[model samples]
Target: MRAVNSHNTPGLAGLRFAFGTLTVLPVRVSRWDRDCAGAGMRWAPLAGLAVGLCAGAAGGLLLLLGAGPLLAAVASAAVPAVLTRGLHLDGLADTADGLGSGRPAEDALRIMKQSDIGPFGVLALVFVLLAQVAALYELYGRGWGYGATAAAVAGAAARLALTLAARSGVPAARPEGLGAMVAATVPARQALGIALLVTAGFAAWGTLFGGYGAPRLALAVLAGAAAAELLLRHCVRRFGGVTGDVFGGVAETAATAALIALAVGFR
Candidate 1:
């Protein structure tokens, strides 16, 4: 799957594909094939790193400007939504609605594809957003650095879940959509390797902060990934496979779980 562009390096092509599809960024994607998408999926955490950086920067600036932790937290929470055009959030809501519908697999999927959000979707969005903001608020109250790192780590961790999801053997629930384009594109070994590197990198960064920070952050990210994996399994069973909405749901689930873990840990 060496879907490189004639004018761009392989890495650049992958980054472009990652950012172009996963975000509302201005980067143009030169290729739309599965090879390109696979490369992009492998690079997803990098795209998330960018999103998290911007998110952290926004919240940190708000804190510098004298905004309270809660307000800064809200600003932090809004960045990912704005950056990703709320597609993931929408997917979370849809997945919630579909799951809550308690219908058969085919019917539940049909409900998920509907344009309007149901009560379950509304509730899920409200609670998830509240969880994210509250966790972020706790981190910000500790200090801007804590909040910023949490934001960045959570963002990367969230996409790490997606990288795992896209690895071999996960089938797409639908024949179409972004899930189908990227599903099973990554080798399981490659995905696991990336996961280890990401976790180790974040843990090393935490070590710079000294003491228990390293283990705390490492556990937080692993906890987040665990939560997302559970959701992925449930979605696979209930929906019969993965979908764009399932991807979104798992990503948000991972972020929220990480943030909460970071907020509550090492106290």
Candidate 2:
């Protein structure tokens, strides 16, 4: 399977081809046939949507069963990790370690690529996961509706944040890696689709939950997106562009931010 390059061809086949490369989804397509690769990045939000729904459904079921909020929170938090094979969580940890040390972006990227986890990475992961679980538990204990809304929002918004980050000027941290594939393959249309998916998902969630009356939820998503953008810009300026790790970091950070908002009062 040849990697899909933006040059030469762009089509649905190309799109499927590229997406197939990243995921183990059993899609049927010709081998590396040159064609216009449609916007594969746009599908990221869709993937998030599926993951979010699965998580939310699990949570909603738990709630309906009168299960404690703790079970719902655990299910919500674990679903994404299972769906994406823990890609974003790993990215979050790597990025935190790289960026937390106050090293240059290049050095930071290097640290991120290293296999072993450092203090910063481990700490960041623990705190972020803890925040997610605690926030969901708190929100659900008050109202499953609120927790459900946050879960749906988080499922899409995090990926949207990452898409935005990929479009930022940040270059791939490594010569050829997941980051390079994302940076190289992502297009404006794909980014726009991601945005639309996020908006639609959030709006649907709000409608279902009688509006995220909690202003904090909206603020959290926005803040997360903005933070991801700023971080991407900074990384791009410092290192010429973002990598797969950076993009994943953006998603994880956005999810964490949204959860935090859910935990705090938004009224």
Candidate 3:
């Protein structure tokens, strides 16, 4: 579970960083410098893919065991949370509290940093989790393949948004924290390249699944990216820049948007 260090090849180091920070996996990231963070963000989709596969496998296995789609969907939704130790969800709740407060940027940031969940945070958590499970249920109803593939696509898309958000020119709201350490670390060109590659990879994944699955998946990622972009912009405007909580919020938003798009658009 030890993470690869800076001394390792760049790609391996990046993968190590991505998995180490993004998940509860045993990978131990030794380097937290900007270079490592940049590469980690670039490789974030790989971490997402791994998480998705595990989640989808859990749901798919439940379906094979004769479980109902509703139960399977709940299982699928639960895996990512368990895997990440609910870090993203917590971030989502905090970001919701911050945004819903309508306080000034400093005040809102402070609220987000608080450990307690405000009313806005609770509402946001309930609705977003509902959206995720509902969409997963629909996909599972279509068949295990649909649900599994959607899980992977949504997961990858979720991390892809993080990569995009870390591109050059994006600022961190504060001078410290994970968000600032990784902020704008990725070059714009590199981000664009990684995005295109991820999209192409997803399309390739769908080709094996048949139908218009390719476009559906590609579009799911696009939709997720677009949705994340909107949230990112709004957060930046409201909070003065991005924070770890905002990153979590964007990831969840992207994942949900991707799942919904895949559920309704392709079929």
For all candidates in order, the CA lDDT equals 0.91, 0.69, 0.91
| 139: Cα error in model 1, Å | 0.4
Off by over 4 Å in 2: 1-38, 187-197, 211-220, 265-267
Model 2 superposed RMSD (Cα): 4.8
lDDT tens digits by residue: candidate 1, 1-267: 978457356667777998998889999997787888888889998888889889999999999999999999999999999999999899999999999999999999999999999999999999999999999999999999899999999899889989999999999999999899989999999999988888998999798778888988888889888999999999999998999999999999999999999999833
Ranking by lDDT: 3, 1, 2
TM-score of each: 0.96, 0.80, 0.96
| Candidate 1 displacement at residue 261 in angstroms | 0.5
lDDT of 2 by residue, 1-267 (tens): 989643434455544654464334565444442122224455555556566777888898998998999999999998888777788888878877877878887787788888888898899889889988998898888877767767776776777775676553435667787666666455566565667556655554454445455345556667667766766666666656777777777888888777777678532
Give the TM-score (vs. native) of candidate 1: 0.96
Over 12-57, each residue of candidate 3 has an lDDT whose tens digit, in order, gives 7778899999999999786678888999999998999899999999
RMSD of each: 2.2, 4.8, 2.8
Candidate 1, pairs of clashing residues: none
